[model samples]
Target: MTYSASMAVQRLFPTDEGHDLLDLTREVVAKELRPKVDAAEAAAALGEEFPTDIFRILGRAGLLSLPHPEEFGGGGQPYEVYLQVVEEIASAWMSVAVGVSVHSLTAFPVTTFGSPAQREALLPGMLSGHQLGAYGLSEPLAGSDVAAMTTRATRDGAGDDGAGDDGATDDPAYRIRGRKAWISHAGHADYYTTFARTSDARGRGISCFIVPGDAPGLSFGAPEKKMGLHCDTVREVIYEDVPVDAARRIGDEGQGMPIALAALDAGRLGIAAAATGLAQSALDVAVAYAKEREQFGRAIASNQGLAFLIADLEAAVLGARAAYLFAARLKDAGRPYGKEAAVAKLLATDAAMRVTTDAIQVLGGAGYTQDFPVERYFREAKVTQIFEGTNQIQRLVISRHALG
Candidate 1:
């Protein structure tokens, strides 16, 4: 699991701190992540246990807050620099990379739209990495179409839900009741960044909140049985009359979709970077195996066909890395990058799938078995195509941008 990071990827940082940040990331990954990746993933596959300690390790290194404002416990790194760090983490251990991405995703609403007081109160804890966050958006009935979500957050006042007598003394709160499916860190998160409908108006009716994990009536379904990323947990987040303080709401009512979309645009880049890293890891394995494994009097890597396949896979990995970085750069510049983000997610994830599959092909029988990591890579690659808006949805986003 000695992963040589991409040397060909050209990174231009506006500050020397950016370079130092990446160096810190690599040192942490090599020291803390790579050594235990396989065993952790294997345990996770059977036990459904998430590596909370690893996330804390990342948080302690200031890895979790790289892109936010330093005033709010962030590292103040740009998206371009932050994403490269993510790519490096994913190259070593994808589950931790994904965990970091999802945690960052959950913090977006508070970072971007929360009140000054809310930011002062919440951002420090969330960005610290000691407290993980979960996003509650997609339900079983509503996946890609977030507007179709049925989760409702009702304003609980002195009259209703039994908050009595001293009306003037009580702070405002809302009772959220709903189920969120496919939520990462569902049971374990310290907070849930939830989107729930506050009115009957389709997409515009929704609102966002930071619901405390230990709140009364907050619960989670059992962890999902998944294909890969076992060290990351996915489960249904359930809220039954969960009372969240009004101060916890991130944005104004009816502004949830925009906040969600903004976070999603950045999140798409994260997935793209992570997927590219996975591809890089798979390609590395394929190359190392090809060099050592022999057939018919010499190394199988000597065969022109196998060598060509390896070369093509390397090219694809590099392309996937470039695609995500391009989108990350646009975001770093404060440019409109929704379309580019979609394009990166589509291309990079698809490339991961293809490259991992081809890696398996090159490894032949050994790749198909658990003895080599290629099979696990193949399993993991499939989900990247499905989540963060499927590749098909990415094409739709790209097409709309193209049309306009």
Candidate 2:
């Protein structure tokens, strides 16, 4: 019924600041996010209501910008510490955790690749949580093939079209026309960091733009009925002659692929941490159930079969945590972490898929229903492997890195 990672997980973070931040994170997740999860998820599954209120609570708490600079209203923490916060929150509620991670990913382009003027003008509100962002990269045909995207951003004459300054700018603009599928915060975010083709070259033609939610011709499809993470809504972001100011562009033309891959290198680690937390939560529920549930005059956990399974699940959770933590440390230390990020995502998400399913086995028939949260965890675990680049794509990244 409750969620907590092992206390020993703190040993991974040696600094006092890490401990304090994670302590605050645990308190927030337990007090605010966990209690409302079931009902919120149920409601979201039936309608288009994403948890804007809970999201604002996190933003106000400064959890929304953990890895960004303090100058831009971020927490200014290292990814190593930020990711643990993600894991902790995820143990309580995967949807909120995913939402936080996606929001962070949405900010990456502007913060990391944007021009100085763009950062000064936009990053403050974005980092401060006055605005929420959705990353628009994956299209219906381009989920993993970044080169296959069809979204295009063409230079516009001027802002006379009047989208209310059009992402709050007066610079030359671009008319973006394309649909991004499987966007995490579609219909609910304040801005969209859109990627579109500016040339015909597969790898060199793509460009990134910060498209406002109110930009003309920007529309969202109805929410998709996904099998898990119900409260983290996903929908299509359609841009039809949507005018985005040139000032809102993140970087030079034809730089989107590299920028996107760079962001994914970090985002994958966030997802890896989240998947570990989900597995950890499922493990906790299974352990508690096994310890208390009686079976033929003995607790189910007393049986070697169930106990070893639980033990293995625990090991998998620990391994997953270690994998993501390793990648996060690499990122925090300012080392090249792309390959390690892929490895961590591959290990953690696959481990989550296995661990949550095994947790259900420990619960037997009781695990199949909504009475326990493990079923939800099981469903949630599945998508982690599919998104942030599929586990298949992670393998490709890893293999290429290793061979090179």
Candidates' C-alpha lDDT:
0.86, 0.86
Model 1, span 1-404: residue lDDT tens = 34364434566777898888877888898889988988999999888778888988999999998998899899888888888889889888888898889989999888888777778888999988689998888999999988899999998874222122211225446889989999998898999999999998866899888888898998888999998999889999888999877677777778899999999999999999999988988898888888888898898999999999988888888788788888888887888899999989998999999999998998899999998888988888899998889898899999999998
Candidate 1: which stretches are off by over 4 Å?
Answer: 1-12, 158-172
Error of 1 at 240 (Å): 0.3
lDDT of 1 at 249: 71
Question: Each prediction's TM-score against the native?
Answer: 0.94, 0.95
> For residues 90-158, what per-residue lDDT tens digits would candidate 2 score against the true structure?
888899899899999999998899766677778898988667889999999988988999999888776
Give per-candidate clash totals: 0, 0
TM-score for candidate 1, residues paired by index: 0.94
Cα RMSD, model 1: 3.3
Which candidate tops TM-score? 2
Error of 1 at 132 (Å): 0.7
* Model 2 backbone overlap count: 0
